[model samples]
Target: MPTSASQEALTPLRPYCGRFAPSPTGRLHRGSLAAALASRLDAHAAGGRWLIRIEDIDPPRDIPGAGEDILRTLERLGMPSDGPVLWQHDRLDAYAAVFEDLKAKGAVYGCACSRKEIRAAAQALGLPEGVYPGTCRGGTGGREARAWRFRVPDRDVTFVDRLAGPYTQNVEKAVGDFVLKRADGLWAYQLAVVVDDIFEGITDIVRGADLIDNTPRQCLLYEALGAPVPRYMHIPLVLNDRGEKLSKQQGATPLADDDLLGELERAFVHLGFERIGADSIEAFHREALRCWADRFAEEPA
Candidate 1:
């Protein structure tokens, strides 16, 4: 069993070990830059390690040079990681090991339900308000291989976010039985991320608010795998004119190489970092680090 002391040690304000896990579906945009800078600063300010991980498990959606491009962009913006980058594609065996453990613990099962089938089942049950109903919990059949889903408990999984404050989600309702491995033979984000974060010994997770809901599911995975859950900080997302989050699927423009400094400044400001003079990228990083250290110096015990 884990102790409160161990949990307290994982706090974001403590010796920071943060990471920016970006998918390789497209080039780095303003949203990605903000997350990268925030995680880097948070780690560096606490004199901890800042690492980068490429979430390229979904090969179908990955671009050929997108990961390399993202690394180059981060370097140009003066946010180089402390160690070698972690490529999720190269860590399939690790994910599989955890998946097998979960299966042995009776915490995961397969579901043959298609997207259309799920939608129709949701409507038929008249409980389409929100959340998955876990129609195929027991088993659909052994005839065809389908997606694997983790079994959610009835109680709530709660966590405190540094920025968003307290958040609670009843895993059984909020996000029903979530996928571990997809029908396309790709390991789901929930499983891969949980395993990777544990493997990398990440202590703080700073990412877009869109992933805020994902924390609970990940927490449950951490518990099931007997791994420590990291502290989370979800920064506000960069939205478009229509109030939609900026994303590659929405055709968000990539950050231009020439405007690296300007873009980094914009990302810093967007992340609630107060700008304090200095023009160059190195100066920006130095000031940002100082600001963060001073800001967290008064954190309550």
Candidate 2:
């Protein structure tokens, strides 16, 4: 049994916390509004909790006040979270603790390769680009540790996406010894996300299909950490006229806080649900959720 202090450091006891984690790289665009609406509807429809998480782990990518702006936008859209918002930056200590545990278990090792080196090695091996070749896995040959990486198991990581259906990836061949911490000192997404999900007791993760590929990596982390993996649902991408995903980097416009109900109807249609006229924001949720339940038989969350 863990001591009281260590127990406090472990995952909190809770149930059914589903979250909408958005990187504050830019404002809440139309695409982001859809994700928030889906997560809120699924959580509420299933009598679960909906939480907001600011994924500001990459400081250099974060725009000034983008996270706060997203919160305001969610409030304006009538989709407020049911709990205190989680900011990744505030949970660094928690992530560091998990890192220490992994290190002690010998599940992770020092890596000395750069992105360029990995890409070059991948090309030479005729493997997919961006897949690390695990050159430094066997002790890095005494080279200075530039990063820390998990030693991926040879087996496959597989799971059924609630919307997109079954998926699989062999981490060793497809991704190879993925990073846990970067040389520049940022915690890797695979580590921070799994740690936060376990800590928050998240039961479901609903987001855009653009992240479908990353799910397997996260599932592998969940297994390594002895945490139960959550069900996943990767919804269709909101595409611009050019068939590109609607994103801040793609110049998608920020959502207007004043157009809550109107945008709600728009998102409903965007998700292929029946459009509803807003008598009130509350009624709008009822009608929209009815449409969702009709489609999914039950809300996945």
Candidate 3:
């Protein structure tokens, strides 16, 4: 079971291990850079290990050489991973093992319903739209299984975010029985991410607020697997002109190669830090680390 807030306050802090996982859909944009920088600063402030992971599981959307490009960009911008990069595509065996384990525990089941069918079932049953109605929970009715879904419990999951404070979500109502593996036979993000975080011993996850909704589902997975849930800090996203979160789909442009220090400074300010006024990259990082520790230090136990 997860430690309660009261219990957590009494325990010593764990060895800090953090990661910045980015999909290889395109080059790193300003928004992604801000996320990477914030994660790096947070880890450095805590005197922890900060690593990188290439979330390249979905081949259909992945660009050729994009993973390598992202790693190269980080290195050029003076924010390289402290450890070896974990490529999700190379960890298929690990995901498969976790899937098998969930199956053995009866925490996941075959789901044959298509999107259209699920919507129809939800309408017929008067349930909220887009939330799965557990159509195949009892059985697939002899229909060929098109996907595998995790059986979310009907209860509230609450967790504390370093920046966003305490939050709760009832996973079963918000997302219902979410897919563990898609109809196309690929591992789902929730399963892959939780398994990888466990394998890597990630103690903290600091990323963009765009992923905040994914936390509750992941927390449930951690409980089902009997693994400890990590601390999270969901920083504000760098939005586009339309106020939409900047993303590849939103036509966000890649980070420019010229003036790396200037670009880093912009990202630093976007993270709510005052201008460090450092002439060199090394000096800038040094000052940024000090400033980050001052502002976002962990509360006293």
* Tens digit per residue, CA lDDT, model 3, 137-202: 999999999999999888888788877877788878887999999999999999999999999888
Local distance difference test values of all predictions, in order? 0.83, 0.82, 0.88
| lDDT of model 1, residue 56 | 95
Between candidates 1 and 3, which one is better according to TM-score?
3
Q: Which stretches of candidate 1 lie over 4 Å from their true place?
A: 1-15, 141-143
lDDT of 1 at 90: 96
Q: Give RMSD to native, each candidate.
A: 2.6, 5.6, 2.0
- Each prediction's TM-score versus the true structure: 0.93, 0.92, 0.95
- Per-residue lDDT of 124 in model 2: 94
TM-score of 1: 0.93
Name the TM-score of candidate 2. Answer: 0.92
By TM-score: ranked, best first: 3, 1, 2
TM-score of 3: 0.95
On a 0 to 100 scale, what is the lDDT of residue 173 in model 1?
69
lDDT tens readout by residue for model 2, 1-301: 1111112112222455689999999988889888888878877766679999999999989998999989988887777889899999999999999999999999999998878888898899998987888898788887899999999888777777777666777878888999999999999998998898888889888799899899878877877788777877787888999999999999998776677788888888888877798788889988887766677665332
Q: Which candidate is the best by lDDT?
A: 3
